[model samples]
Target: MKISAGMIVWSFCLAMAAGFTRSKPDIGVPVALAYFKTNAEVFASATGELQQSIDKLDDDPASVIKARLALKNTRLQYKKIAFFLEYFFKSAALIYNSAPKYEIEEPYMEYREPTGFQVIESLLYEAHPATKKLELLQQADVVTSSAKDLNALLYGFTANDKQLLESIQLELVRVITLSITGFDAPLLKTGIAESEMSLRALQTVLQPFREKATKTGVEVANYLSGGIAWLHQHPDFDSFDRLHFLTNYALPLQRSLQVFIKELQLQLNTTHVLNYEAGDLFNPAFLNLIAFLGADSSAQWQIGLGRRLFFDPGLSGNNKISCATCHQPEKHFTDGLTTSNAFDGHSHVPRNAPSLFYSAFQYRQFWDGKAESLQSQVKTVLFNVQEMNADSLALVKHLQQDTTYSKLMGAASPIDQIARCIAAYVRSLNPRSSRFDDYIQGKGPALSEDEIKGFNLFMGQAQCGTCHFAPLFNGLTPPLYDRTEFEVPGITRTDDLLHPVADTDMGRYPLFPMDYYKQAFKTPTVRNTAATAPYMHNGAFKTLEAVIEFYNQGGAAGLKLPIPNQTLSPLPLHLTPNEAASIVSFIHTLDDAEPTGLFIKKSNQ
Candidate 1:
């Protein structure tokens, strides 16, 4: 009558499948708390079994397979409560499952080694798991501790209907952006199954609310059912139709959930970067653009002043250069240079002047991410010796002399105010009027067959969507859009893939002073990429084709460059020329129509 670990897990699954064998109908916060507690126990149990298997590595040769199975089951259990755990207790979630890379906390300079399930997963899937036995055991212990800690935290955990619904929505986004991309499960490629489990958990969480809101509930349930079925049908990682999965299942589910929440009369109390009122993910209004700026009516008034200053050459040390000189409005806010002209007009700036469109959406500004905000970025540019090199106090005095400027300023305008105003104008640049935007919003003509294929390849095989993400097509991660990501792609000094030498520019490394951050640059948006040529932080590639080829060659590492800390995968993507061209065509679809000076017009009024 002794029960094996497999039997225990099977029994737990059976209990979960039977709705935890509760005689009463599942509904409300009490049911949710109960489900959470029970699931936590199962997770803890699975982790314990995994630890036991790891401990038995030397005694039993089959323990490696057993440990792997146990780890998978443990992760599956974690998925059941991932919505609650990840949303409510993000710090604890990190302990349970953080990225397998070493992280360094900025400013504080505290270096943290990788830990949790991803660490253990990498070890278990390795060719020499036995050689890493000690490390595996240590990670297993960490997972066990984390699982128990999660259980401890769940003791008094309580969530209202709105919170639960919001968590579910965020979970859906995570599935789309992170889970199915094999981000967390890079070695195992178990994300597809994990995503299905995540959806099932969401369904269970919504079961109580569904009874309260019938019509919207039915729509939500159907979408969930269809999405889950689709995931179950297509479990393969690389070949999965991500674009179809996103458009047909995930996007619709998000829309339905919004309606379902409204029908239940529950409004989110949290302040998120995303505009909850936006009905579609790719809708232009999907993100709250002003949320980042902390803008007000007065700030809106400053945009006109900002636009004037932006076009004024007097702000610079010399009387001849303006922001518009480099960020020409007609050229999609890029000067069509490999790097912009310096203050001397003879020399070039160190990096390319990226397109201003959608720049406001990013969490960080600048290629090296040295500037924390748009205002900060503007201030740096105004003072950089190689760039504007303007004395702030003098610039302020010079601007105040103009009667029109004095009228706009309302008596006094500080240097900080000037930077703020310019930042406001820059923030107003996002028009989201691309053909891709129109297509995603369902208000424009269908994309070409090549464009669709390119999009699929981008999202699926090319692994572009894994970093750029959708809607914004930037490295600002979705669900929480709080953190912008920087990666060391190991960009080469030249476009020569065969004799690639790593770019000499030390990118974020100089600021952070970490080997890991060497050549780490912000992942800029591909929104108007076709318009803004000569890409990468250092403008190493002169054309979009070269940029695509660089990626296709799997960055510098694939070209046999010694970029030990490169974040991009070294293995080649094996994309055909037609495939690469198609991706480029899809990128062209992201080009916004000419800016009509939307903010300038409003400011003039």
Candidate 2:
């Protein structure tokens, strides 16, 4: 009498497939909400059954297999409505699941807890059978509750037309970028199948638009259908052509859908999450910071005043020092030193000076991630004894005496205004173009063949993109750059090639002592890495080759260091010499933007 979890999911998918593509007679908020509520119960039901299957697991091989299949089915069911779920009800979506190689933090949560589907998937898909059965049960319970919450949210949800369209567009992005890139199903490699289901759901969403603009709608539908069919044909995700998918399919679809939106006369809505123009994929507006700042933020008079303060030595203890002392713009805002010389010149700064280019784009700042924003990071450098070694009050007094600074900066203390201006200036350094970015935006010849190959390896075999992620090539996980991600990469003190010095830096642990974060540090952007090295938080490697080798050997695990929770896989990547070279070539293309002169002044000048 009991229905299997697979049966439950299949039935729902079949129902969705049957009715979803029919071009629902009515196309409005109430109808969309109604359609969602009608189908929402199925998602919760499948998840509950999945939890039960997981709880029933023990020594039996059959039971373990059953649990795994149920997990897969439950995942597919969620994919059915992932777009709408993630866009409107993000808070509830977190409880359900998230992308891999990243940690998420919710605003109201007391403390960060590793709960959700991916955590369960990791345990289920482990090489060895589940050892911690109790932990699996707990996670399954959380999934069940999260699903129930999602259904409740759906019942109360009232999405406007613009919001609905925005969700559809964002979903397409998540599909090709995150889903197709094999980000969501890291352990299972089920991205191909999951993407198919997601695309099928996408087809249903577009059916309503077909009523308004038949030709544009048909074009979008063809792209979606073709993309889904392509995914099915190329089942082997390891060899999947992500570039082709992004450019030929996903990019075209985005443009077509934009036309459809215009034809329908729906007001163009923008979101801070993915405010990119469908005209190009590499647009900087894709970045949350760029979206928040807008195109005109850089030209603000406050930012202009901040630029002068950055090069002025008044912010430092001695009039001889300035923000540019260590952060040279010509060197991509880095000093081109392993550890920069301190304001006193005798001592060295504790950490390597980071690039200001795209520095303000992240959710947090600094290698330790102690500073919450670009302004706070500036505050730390200005006051830290090893750096500027200046007092805020004294600096304010000194800046106030400067007639130009006092006149340009408003009523706020010169120091505070300077920090804000500096922050704005940093944000203005955001890069919208790179050879690799150009390639993604459909200029295929922008990157060399080897560099393109290397990019493929980085995303797939090299495991670099899993942490670095796309676009930013940093720890800000896509679909939503809401929280920052830090990892215990176990970077040694030096790249000795042999007898490498062990990394003793207790990253993030000083702030909150969690076992996993012991020696964990923030993952900075690899964008200008070829220029920004010495690499890692400690400046261990002098060259990109050495850095690649360190990761190839498997981070702390490869070094035989005792980091139980090292996020990086210790297993050797088995990358050939050419593969590594190609990766370096790809990284080389990340340094595309030229240095703007405003932040590039020499001390003598």
Candidate 3:
């Protein structure tokens, strides 16, 4: 029988259907295991095709197109298995499709260069693909080798039913935050199709559990089918109604999956950043703060104690400045200055004082992301000669002199106690009581038409959601929020849009000493931008309008500034003035509603 191409495609689809529809299992493990085995083989086969296509690349223009097509197919095949592969083999998965940028690991501080599909995608889509042939061949080799090693790792792997469900839930989060946002497929813009493929694979693995789930099972199936169909109908990248998709399909799907899991009596492991108990994505409790910062039973007491320390000027060398000096509560933890005043009171700090609200959510701290944790950030600010300029011994003794702090200090080291207490106060700042949060949770007034439009623009056309992910709207990437991302937006020295000159702040480069890290600063949360003014690391843009205009013109690159490594796309957003104002209005909706006791004023000394 001579196998025709159409027959080969049909056979492949048939085999996949058989794998999914085979005798329904009692539990999810067997189904997951079978799906993994089958998809792993498919991924390996697609990888082989990619390798062959890459080998055939030459002066022939058709060869390049064939290679690109092969690469895209291989990516789609890999998407079919991304859920399990990412959940089980996270480290290896990093090599497969992490961002095509140099990553610096914290603490140990190891620099890992980019590899895999994204790098290949960038190479293939570049203006001159022929020039990148050598590098493309190398990246292809890395991907193929990594895929084979992963297959080896999956040979006899076993996972519990609860873990499989948990992985599925996380995959939904990934699809919402990463896949639909074109995060991994920057050049290809194939995130929507990839999301559909991922959902199809998820549906296959979920069949056994879905069947057992009864009524809840029906809800889950409808959401899966509906979401897939929605993606199919709206294939255009720029005009895709992300807001509608998220509210109607993605959010409902997530809720239904939880219901299905509960109905099946499956327990989820709560060690991840995503809180399994949260009902919706924008719930105040959406992220597991406890997972981000280890559980503190005494957080309430620590927060109160920390508030006093935060307001005490004795913590500084001159006994005149406190944490509140730079981070004023009334101003939303920012001083409303272009840059904060230094210890000398005559000079200014190099960077703006970013709001402490939602500060505890990210893995890295500071503009350069040099501090590894909130505690480290507290310590660094306290001891820095240019900032607080605190004398460690004197500060400790000063705190120990206070009866209240002395009691809290007890047997703990004074410095450690101070750091912990102040850090605790900062951690307690995130209230997540914004109007947007309320609307997302189905409680607040419906967002205005303009506000809704602005949000859709932010998520899709504006491309803000790609970096400032939803829920937290911070650089902490979702699914597994282990790493914080930094980007170089090529900010200018001042708010002058017409005569823009690239700022001389080397940003993360001074710490990492890498070219790519140049001008790369940690992406901060825009949740309270309405309160925190003078945006960016240097606070060059005074008004929110100026900042929006700067971005509208595509950062410094759009301003014709020299920024070879600007990570922000240089393409103009072309936002009308009205559209810009609408976005600003939408951002205002993110201001936290008055919490009962968010701010604690200075004590009478």
TM-score of each: 0.87, 0.84, 0.87
- Superposition-based RMSD of candidate 2 using all C-alpha atoms, in angstroms: 9.6
Q: Kindly list the per-residue Cα lDDT of model 1 for residues 1-605, writing each as its tens digit.
A: 99899999999899989867555332466666778889988888998998998887763558777888888888888899888888888887887787676755432345667888898987776666888889988988888887876668866666666777777778887898878777777656678889999999888877888776587788889889999999999988776776678778888888888877777677583755787678657767777776664343346567877888888888899977888888877788888888998999799989989888788887678898888778888889999999999987678778768765665455454777878888888888888888888887777888898898888778767778767877788887776776677788898988877777778888888987878888888888988999888888777788888998988887898888888888777767889999999999899999987657652321242
Candidate lDDT scores, in order, read 0.80, 0.73, 0.82
- The residue pairs found clashing in candidate 3 are none
Whichever of 1 and 2 has more TM-score, that candidate is 1
lDDT of 3 by residue, 1-605 (tens): 89999998898899897875454344878877778778888888888888888887777789889988998889899899899878888888787787776666543456777888988887777666878888988988888877776668866676678888888888998898888878888567788889999999899999877765588788889988999999999987766777778888889888878877877778686555667677557767778776664335446778888888889999999999999999988788889999999999899989999999998888788999888777788889889999888997888688678788865568557787778888888888888889888888777888998888778777766778888987788888777676687889899999988878789999988887888899999999999998889899999988989988888898898788889888887767889898888889889999987677775556542
**Candidate with the greatest lDDT versus the true structure:** 3
RMSD of 3: 9.4
Candidate 1 — which pairs collide? none
Clashes of each: 0, 0, 0
How far does residue 400 in candidate 2 sit from its true spot (Å)? 6.4
Regions of candidate 2 where Cα sits further than 4 Å from its true position:
1-70, 99-110, 141-157, 268-270, 276-281, 288-300, 391-412, 442-444, 496-502, 513-517, 595-599
**lDDT of residue 525 for candidate 3:** 96
RMSD (Å) of each candidate, 1 decimal: 9.8, 9.6, 9.4
